[model samples]
Target: MESYASSSARPDRAEPCPRSAVSHGVGLAGLAGLALWTVLAWRYGMDGPHAGIFASVVACGVPMLLWSLLVDRVHRRPSTGIDWSGPRRSAREGFDISVVKLAGLWATWGAIALFYGTARWYWDGGYSYAMQLFGWAVVPLLLASIPYVIWLDRYLIEPRDGAYAFGQWVIGGAAGKPPEGAIGDHLRAWGVKAFFLAFMLSITPANFANVIGWRTGDPLAGPVELANFLITILFMIDVSFATIGYMLTCKPLDAHIRSANPHMAGWIAALICYPPFVLMGNGGPLDYHRGTAEWDMWFAGNAAMLWIWGGLLVLLTAVYAWATVAFGLRFSNLTHRGIITHGPYRWTRHPAYLSKNLFWWLSVMPFLSTTGNWVDVVRNCTLLGITSAIYYWRARTEEQHLSEDPDYRAYHAWMERRGVVTRALAALTRWSGRGSPAAHPERG
Candidate 1:
């Protein structure tokens, strides 16, 4: 939320963003659904199988979808590009269009399948789990796409979106040409979905299993253990919502991607943070955990310090998860589905990144080596610094992408004027007699 300074105190305060497309209420609905599901699963010890974990997603998604449709009326939004009042085209006339659309859609899936097959990483490590998921989903998806395309085609104002355009190109004809760069845009969007969805699915099972399987006589016995347990639950929430996001990018719920990030830097910066490409993985270049112990280790005998530090870390982790919760079902990297200004987003634009980096620093003190080696300290700290720099780059590129949208520009302007971090930075900038930084921005 922007500052609430009255006119008497402040002369120039900008207006808030025009709309927060994702409602705070909708996120609460999802949270409610997930909480109910968590209770039942915990009671039954339904934590052994990945399938039950997948079902937890349904707990959240079903309610969110119902709330979005019945309460928020999201499907009626003009942004959805659906015109419910339009007269239907004759079945014969619409049949060809639907066929072409399905063709394009299937072709896109085929290309993704080929890529999955060719990519050695997909068959190995965590990605192998994602492949297993794809195996189960492909058939149902193929069958479902047929009716989905035909039904949606009837309402779309211009149904010949990226899939239709790409399909035309694949089929080869003059009709396939959809202005310039349309096909490129289509491919870029799919590329984003393919890459990130796998990563999300790949980790969901493991993380969900960990959270549900966490059994202890009293996990709350110690402050540090209680904090850890709570943080794990938060991460579980983040994972479930994020997976729901990648899965629900469709118009019916008004959560379709308006555009994927067109910038290469955005893609590279995001991809490097996950899976086989992750630079911070074990033995990777940015592995900063080489000679460090948990932050609590330093305060082992000091109960007060341990509790204080643990509470701080848990708070940061909650902030990180709250950022994901704000996204509801539209969260994804390298894509702009819509502008969101609720939940943790009210304080700063990048709550997840800020809180996440803070948690890492406080939790690992990676610079303080257990071996008392200066080289380890410098290497670890420098590497972690670079990791943060990459997040900064990722943030700038996201802002650059979202800048194309006037609403986001308005939101950015509002943040510059009233956001806690942005306003503070501006004051510091003016105090130092240098203007606020450009292309470099901060969020909660």
Candidate 2:
């Protein structure tokens, strides 16, 4: 084993990069080049046959050819400046503006291209009917995105630029200084928050459009449309509650919750749930046919399941509302309250996370029993699982930050002692074992 000192002395050389690094670098370079050329061709109005040939060459071959010759230039630099472990807050004033400006442009053109391509095919033959409907459902999202982009650019970005002067002019005390916490350095958090808020808001219009299109038989199917509709509604409710909680606990949105990083959790949750909407809207793997528009046996059963499960999600949202309001009432100071193992926390350290999973799971009930639809169910469930995993990690990181607090340690210990989850698991295991014995009898 290498000594710590030896390892420290030549960190880069201690464990040299894998032999396949060159191949991996080449692959990435090729991909980026392909993407760039594809964008260029689309911009230049490429047509069929010749356009297809030229696009393939530019998008696939050109990047590879260039990368093969100038690998050093292609793979010269690694990304830097992101301090994942750094302080959570900063004083930067207008950082959000630049981010919104750039991401807005990218999202705008990308959305246009996506919609145009999908629409052309959809109108051509309905061969990809499911995909076209999904795309149409996303139209409202595009509509809402415009205001959101402007909002971020105005409220977030502009302020960060001349915020220092503005702050000094507005306040007699600490006028010129950046607002507390590590000034300027943590503005990236604000940028992240602005991006997510805009993104989430953008979805609402699309969801509305989807419901309308489905009702009118314009493409988006009934089952797929219903699934996305409920999920989007739940998400909107969640954000509304969170915002209320924030306002109730913190000051005006402008005052507290200004730093981006700490507020990023909500945005992260949005990102976690976004893609599943598209996947579920695409009608799963097997082209599910509910037969006719009339209510059938399967339809009735699934509809009942949807109501029951969706009701449970409504209950969960209520739980979120209560918990969020309670959090504000308890920790209005914006500081972490140790382990926070109270109320819903007592049942599970993160009830909000579990509730989020519940909502998505409920949304998948319509397709749960169908064979191919299982793919949609699994895809949605996986998204929830991954999101929960991310929250678990964030919870640990938070615990580390607040570990010095005696109350937190006590709460942690109490939660551990409860062992509610372990008991539940044990019961499940016993039940499973008993069922197997009954089914198989004594094999010997």
Candidate 3:
């Protein structure tokens, strides 16, 4: 709802700007400058808010400088043996950019513009209402989101490899050495798909849901419910963080990991995790359009199922966290890391995959309220099921990769021996307790 129109008084033209220019200009400005831009915008009386436009341009530039400084510092003391002089390297010798990199940069800005523009036009009624509604409620929520958005932008944008492909900082030396060409290739494929799908998917359900919820006349569901809804709306945060966490911990320990396989697994993982939310976002509105009363009933059922299944996913989170912490403490490097037999591994060979299935399973249940509506129901169920299958197959592929590694073979033998000894001892103890205490030399 914030006026995106740059005032004619501003010197800059409105033609599609490059990503670097926009990101640097906007980022340097920060939120405070953006606020000033708004005030200046008002002062110009909506005719030509040059002040606002200039302020915005100035603020965005700051981040570019900051980003450059960080990259220079990091690469200045490089240990990876990667030449800062690599052909793709920037003048600062900090980060490298590729055609895909440029594409990512431009695509992000374009997407943001498209989003705000579409929201301004299509969801006009709800946008105005929500602004007023939030005047009392959303202001504080928006204020809180300031830090969160800053964090998201910093991680998602500023760093080389940024959030899309890889993180810039190695952090406790915990990051795995991504397979050769993996970072660039991964970013190219993942970035394109994520950009397009997220833009198309985020607006429709989000606006529709907000509009419908506001229309419900339920005072109790005001800002609090809306806040909760907003968090879920950004479910990508959870999915993305979860993926990053998995990589930090699980990837290195995955003795089966091969350079090629991880990329494929990454794709499979994204397929399983991201697409459902998109389907859900767009589909939620369609279901609601059937009728408000029916929608509410269905929404409750769907929300319940989602919540229930989400609760189950807590188990996966724990596993990912444990692996991350363990790897961080024990071994500095993550790659060719030996397979772990403790924690969740002790229970099942593939706890992560099991967790992956649980994640999707929860996603499917929430829509059961609309089970009668075959399109929405079938569409989600089928994708959910298919993606889960893909994740399972990816897991098998990773296991195969491990099978060839010598370190992995050693760990496998150790685990097998440990398991046999422990199980036999337990059986002997049970037998002795029932009758006589017998020492079994064979078991020893």
Candidate 3, which segments miss by more than 4 Å at Cα? 1-336, 374-376, 410-444
Candidate 3 is scored at a TM of 0.32
Cα-based lDDT at residue 169, candidate 2: 34
My TM-score estimates for the predictions, one after another, are 0.93, 0.37, 0.32
What is the number of backbone collisions in each predicted candidate, taken in the order shown?
2, 14, 14
How does each model score on lDDT? 0.79, 0.38, 0.35
Models sorted by lDDT, best on top: 1, 2, 3
Model 3 scores a C-alpha lDDT of 0.35
- Predicted structure 2: lDDT: 0.38
Q: Which candidate is the best by TM-score?
A: 1
Worst 10 residues of 1 by lDDT: 1-10
Q: Which lDDT tens digits does candidate 3 get at residues 1-444?
A: 000011122213443121110112212223344344434434444322222223323432233224324532322322222233432333333223222233343445445445545545323542433233223543564455334333323222223343223332222133434346645544443343333223323332332233223322443364335433443323322222222222221111121112223345544443333333322234442122221122233346476643443444444545443332222211111123344444434434454556546654543353463436667556555655665565555455555555565545544443333343334544676777863323211000
- The per-residue C-alpha lDDT of model 2 at residue 441 equals 7
Candidate 2 accuracy as TM-score: 0.37
Model 1, TM vs. native = 0.93
